[model samples]
Target: MSTDEHLDPIPDSFILQPPVFHPVIPYGTTIFGGLYAGKMVTLQGVVPLHARRFQVDFQCGCCLHPQPDVAFRFSPRFYTVKPHVICNTHQGGLWQKEIRWPGVALQRGDSFLILFLFENEEVKVSVNGQHFLHYRYRLPLSRVDTLDISGDILVKAVGFLNINPFLLYSPRLEVPCSRALPRGLWPGQVIVVRGLVLKEPKDFTLSLKDGTTHVPVTLRASFTDRTLAWVSSWGRKKLISAPFLFHPQRFFEVLLLCQEGGLKLALNGQGLGATSLDQKALEQLRELRISGNVHLYCVHC
Candidate 1:
């Protein structure tokens, strides 16, 4: 899949997370107003250690009723003939020719994130942030009213995010700045920062702090120390190699995903940030400050 298939960072509205369905096998749920172009469904979970097979289906009607039409069936098998994943359509309870994709990206006892983004002609699927498959619409997209996932897997979260709206694509902003997060620092929300390092810079810091007092959680990338560091008052500060040393003048983007435990950080796709962001941090997190020697371009929280 092309990078264009991925959802944009600046969102007019956020994803709507539905309640997780645990131990869901042969389980199904209604897709409100039916599925459509520009609608996206995301699933995150773990593949059981002893997993045999799993299937996620988008259907006009579920198998609970007879003769249900399955628009898209994503069935991945582990102990199958060749251990491959198949994509197919089932109409009038009859199956179509299967399209096979090799390589089982999900191993036993591993977690995975799956995203299905619908477009006019096809549904783009990505597994663990990597493009997995794309299925052209043999049946009308609007006919898909229910989503069903069955077989061996542990379900954690299922959510929907709309990409049809014209969310304000916040252009670049000035650096050495303190800016408010788009929707405040809430769990499930994401913060995206884009910028370039200054030539011969010693360091730069990105801090998220409370509105009033400056009790802050800072991520500092230092050339002098030759490390990318993380610091909060409580947890042990984490430091690693200084990529900025050779990356000066090169553009970069950082993404922060707020979770229950803490803020999970990523540069491009590499994991960063280490520390538990406690209740106090959530209650007070209000301002995002960027300082030091860097040219800030975009900050979309």
Candidate 2:
């Protein structure tokens, strides 16, 4: 017999159409079975713009799946909805809107992933591998333990899969106190930094060079209450205070990293100073802050 002849016929309950298939599982059917009761699970679906609502159906246990519980609904716009084991409605119609998935206006064949982390405090939803939504539960999970799927769309497939909560990557930052500044320095971002200063002279200056204009970057003493003030000069003749005294051979090098929120100062890879910065100063730093003295080389501030 031919493979087609031996294959089982599509179920009569499902409507198999070009866009919406019945005998075949729809592209957006909600799946709720196999380890989907109390643990978190990852949901994947292909959504066509016309699919209005997507629902998952599951069997509920009296003491396992509770009623009037909040579930985290995740998409581009995150939301919260209450789901029941038997039906979508609550005591009355109070949660009708909450239980129904609104039309997302997705394009045909648009695929997306929804991560539902059902925790004690809230149900966190991550979409497309990014953090998106959080929903608090009003009803306890002990009362309802079943899952169900229903909506104006078809679900291709649904499964309960394990996920690592902390498998995410972050970037590193570096900033110097006496050399050229790095790129991507903004008012709110943090920077890693390193530098030098003479203590004898009461007045010391540090200027971040940017093109033709030299912008003075603020420098605060990490150990003491003393603060250094600086001004940018037009020519090579930078101004210096005569009262400033320096140990003839006691030159120091420091690494200074900073963000608009705060700064950390290090010396030769060893930490020396750290402090929180004023919000106003961080917002005004349009140009990248460079290290080094004005007498050195010109930098792109």
Candidate 3:
């Protein structure tokens, strides 16, 4: 997909589950870590003008002959006289009682959004933001791991939104992104940045700034000096010396943990070092700015 199509801007305040873009029809893929209560699945697509029917199946597995048990089958039939939606489950190679909701809200030849929200007891479905129906679980939700979609629909994107506090995930985020720190910097909070260094790298910096636009803390990864430097309003305290991990064409994750003393730093998952900051200064921070030679993937606050 083109960069423009993939990096559609979303507000930084709310974290999102990474979305799948421009997938081919009859698509089937394993859910990242499987579904759980409070999780949601979103599908964006257009129904073919002459489409007869289409179905989205949440299956235990993509087995063929034995026909893996289907946790949920969401089908929209355009071939019907009045048009309607069908919900059902398949287990032991038998189809369960059909649940029908008449009067389909979807229109052919137009874009649509389908949301499947998983709850502890049932799956709530919404069509283009309107609540449509609910289906109670027959098979264990834990057994559902694969998503299979087929039929006459022009699929655009499919996204999974996992519930997490102060976290966000985007398959791809535009570089030079700045996000707000709504709760400000506080003890016991963590900010994570994941990205790839440009092939021909230059200095890249992640900075925390106050509402007044004054930067209080900044971490710079310099290729020329091959060092990671921590700088703040006080001074450039020290540099993370030799064998720096931020290299050209390499993937890296930088984590900053706010603590009582200051901030704990980590490169990838390993401890890099720590920096001390006055609680007053950390509390004043309101935004995070990232710039220079990096392609961002996800950012969590």
**Model 1 per-residue lDDT at 93:** 70
- The number of clashing residue pairs in model 1 is 0
- The TM-score obtained by model 3 is 0.54
* Residue ranges of candidate 3 with Cα displaced over 4 Å: 1-17, 164-301
State how far residue 12 of model 1 sits from its true place (Å): 9.8
Model 3 whole-model lDDT (C-alpha atoms):
0.80
Cα lDDT tens digits, model 3, 7-103, are 6565442343445667899899888667667567878789999998899999998888899899999999998777799999999999999999997
Better of 2 and 3 by lDDT: 3
**lDDT scores for all predictions?**
0.72, 0.37, 0.80
Error of 1 at 89 (Å): 1.4
TM-score of each: 0.60, 0.31, 0.54
Residue 170 CA error for candidate 1 (Å)?
Answer: 8.0
- Listed per candidate, the RMSD to the true structure in angstroms reads 8.8, 23.1, 18.3
Worst 10 residues of 3 by lDDT: 161-170
Candidate 2 displacement at residue 195 in angstroms? 44
Models sorted by lDDT, best on top:
3, 1, 2
lDDT per residue as tens, model 2, 1-301:
7889975453321111111113244223222322222344444556555554455432233222354332322323222232211113343214534432343334445665544655656666555555654555544533444444445444433434322112111111232334444342454343422122333333333344444344434543322323332333333232222112122222222334555564544322223345454555444444444433211111223
Q: Candidate 3: which pairs clash?
A: 15-168
